[model samples]
Target: MQKSDYFIKGILESDEKVVAKIYNLFFPKVLSFVYRNNGQREDAEDVFQKALLQISARIKLRKLEVINTSFEAYLFTACKNLWRRELNKKQKRVTNDEVKELVSEESDMAYALLDQERWELFRDKLEQLSDNCKEVLNLFLKKVSYDQIVKKLGYTSETVARQRVFKCKAKLIEMIKADKRFRNLK
Candidate 1:
């Protein structure tokens, strides 16, 4: 098996030694990311812990499978995403001056994290949709044109593909709105 597979197995099994190694290997990078994004050391620690918990939960649900990315990249992305959500929450209460300061110093990482959070939420809600809806929405998200979607999904016409995409998008919005976690995140 690959080294990343070992990391995945260790995380799934809660192997102390492997977990410790992962923390030692990846925590610095996560910590640095949080620190650079207006977070303190304690905040970085919290983010790291939360990322680990998310990974554990996904593993338990059989939702985390190592595909294109390494385990390290996955863990780091989780940390960035959690930190970005925290930053969004913090931004709501900050004054205009504070907001300006943050914006002035904003890194590409911050923007990427924001986009990542959005995509993650969309994917989470997409899973709640019907198989047909999932297919249509996924294609739409991938920037497939209406005519292409019609051909690919065997829809009657471009108009049908457009309608399916619109309906699926509406359903996804409804699912997101109904989620308690979505409210909490906002």
Candidate 2:
């Protein structure tokens, strides 16, 4: 089903299954959108997720209603906005032409199909990471140091922390590579 249709149904009725299906359906589009826009599969996944995150935040805040557009357009717009913010976070300045060049392929279909495959592979791979790896990775992203990561994550030893980080990174790389998102990178 088209995710926008599914999502509007989910929102109107608050059906968990409908919501889950919407996530599954629209994520591929968002993933392809992100990857086509100077991001990796991971970035695509993240941008897609942030689209949902924004939805949830809006729901929680009860800030405003998305009244006019299909859920698909709203979702895609959210992803695009979030990615634009991410790119802006970079220190260097980027011109409008560069930004347009990055996402131009998303206006085409072939890139979209590849993105679908990549995100499905991505979701499956995340399920394979160890609990410890996931926890440590979260801490690392929080800007914690090796010592702080070990302490906060309850690792028995720093050696264990380092190994976990290394292994987690290796696993993430392998997962991304196998998914064809980072095949060109490695």
User: lDDT scores for all predictions?
Assistant: 0.77, 0.65
lDDT of 1 by residue, 1-186 (tens): 998889888888889999999989999999899888888999999888877776676666646565346788878888888788778867665734454434332353344444554556766788878999998887888898888898899999998888888888888999888876577456
How does each model score on TM-score? Answer: 0.52, 0.42
- In model 1, the Cα lDDT at residue 21 comes to 98
Error of 2 at 171 (Å): 2.1
Residue 161 error, candidate 2, Å: 1.0
Clashing pairs in 2: none
Candidate 2 positional error at 131, Å: 1.5
Candidate 2 residue 173 Cα shift, in angstroms, is 2.1
- By TM-score, how accurate is candidate 1? 0.52
**Which residue pairs collide in model 1, if any?**
none
Runs of candidate 1 with Cα error greater than 4 angstroms are 95-186
